[model samples]
Target: MADLKVNIGHLALKNPVMTASGTFGYGLEFADFIPLDGLGGFIVKGTTLKAREGNDYPRMAETPSGMLNCVGLQNKGVDYFCQHIYPQLKDINTNVIVNVSGSSPDDYAECASRIDALDNIPAIELNISCPNVKDGGMAFGVTCAGAESVVKAVRERYHKTLIVKLSPNVTNIADIARACEAQGADSVSLINTLMGMAIDIEKRRPVLSIGTGGLSGPAVKPVALRMVWQVARAVKIPVVGLGGIMNAHDAIEFLMAGATAIEIGTANFIDPSVTIKVRDGIDRWLDDHGCHSVREIIGCLD
Candidate 1:
């Protein structure tokens, strides 16, 4: 097998395939389908400073070739994660990352600070796409200033591998990525679901509880590849890409577009063992192509 190892800042991955936050449900939920340690890493569901009840009923809607969701970062809060979840994940023998979200810079920093105390957790993917309550519900990742504030605050407290998850609902995503890098972000992951909506014509109403939600699936792979390519050229820090990556071919496209690593999201719902499949497929492809390592194809696109 070809060497598939890659690094995101100081954190090393056995392979480039990782399960995205929210879709993977803390990694433990999928234990029946795939071995937990077989993955490069698995980011748990979105966690905040305090507990969240999430959105009301009908928070998810299936669309053509994709799905929309406004789950609203539901979780039992950081303390519960540190107390109950950490112990189960600490000895899993794979990288366990926390997806940290908040309404303000302070909340993001405080939540990250608490995760920093966990010895087994080597990284935190700072989710800046959350609605900023202090700023009239606008997401902190839409603008450079907003992205900077949260990254700056979190960087000050959390010292490990800080990977900032960028929102696709922005005019210049590369600019927002640069802002995070300026604030000491160790890495950046992109194309965090595009804003989309579905309507129920028969019922004359919206399909989801919220009128709009983040879109993910094969429908978004093209846009995600473009953004990953653009941001990869713009930032010096490592770029992690995700959005509709369903198989090894899709994952290879992201790596060629300059992503050091890629995350599997919606595909997990369709096939629980997709992560392992993608990882193995990547190795097979590399061997077939005469590449000694997966890194040989990363950014090899011309």
Candidate 2:
């Protein structure tokens, strides 16, 4: 079989297929459907400095070819993760990454600092799309300075593979990516759900509780592909692509477009075994195309 190994900063992956944060539910929940180690890595749900109850009811809604959610980064906080969750994942024989989110730069740094103490956890994907409470609720990822501030704070404390997850709502995503890189980001994952809303025409109100939510699924694939391509060219670090990648063909497209690795999100809800399927399908496609390694196709587009 073609070699599927790849790297994101210093974290090596057995393959390029990883389950996205918030969707994979700490990686343990899907153990019945697929082997935990079968994945390149799995990012656990978003964890903050303190416990969050998440948004009110009806936080999710169905879109045409995708889904919208405003889950509000709900989790039991980092201490609980470090105390209860870390032990179970430490010996899993695969990379277990933490998705860190917060309302301010200090919050991000402190949460990352705690996760940095976990020996088995090699990376943290900073979710900067969170509202900046100090900035009147503007997301830290929408502007270069906001993105840099969070990364800078986290970089000083977190030390391992620091990946900044970018927001698609920005004007020039590449500029935002460059800002993260400037602050010592090891990698950048992109297209973290597009901003969208679904209206309940019959009820005469919005379908989601937050009025708007991040969109993800088949409908977003094209836009995500374009953003990955642009940011990959702009940054020197590796790029982790996500947003509607459902199968190997979709994953392969991201690889070719310049992503060193890709994450599977919304698709996991439809098929629990999709990560393994995509990994194997990538190997099959590589062999059929006479390629010796999955890396051969990364940024192969000319």
Writing each residue's lDDT as its tens digit, candidate 1 over 196-285 gives: 999999999988888889999999999999999999999999999999999999999999999999999999999999999999999999
Over all chains combined, what TM-score does candidate 1 have? 0.99
Poorest 10 consecutive residues of model 2 by lDDT?
56-65
Per-residue CA lDDT of model 2 for 1-302, tens digit only, reads 99999999899999999989999998999999999899999999999999999998799998888999999888999999999999989999889999999999999999999999899999999999999999999999999999999999999998899999999998899999999999999999988989999999999999998899999999999999999999999999999999899999999999999999999999999999999999999999999999999999999998
Q: Given candidate 1, what's the lDDT at residue 211?
A: 84
lDDT of each: 0.94, 0.95
Q: State residue 139's C-alpha deviation in candidate 1, in Å.
A: 0.3
Candidate 2 contains a number of clashing pairs equal to 0
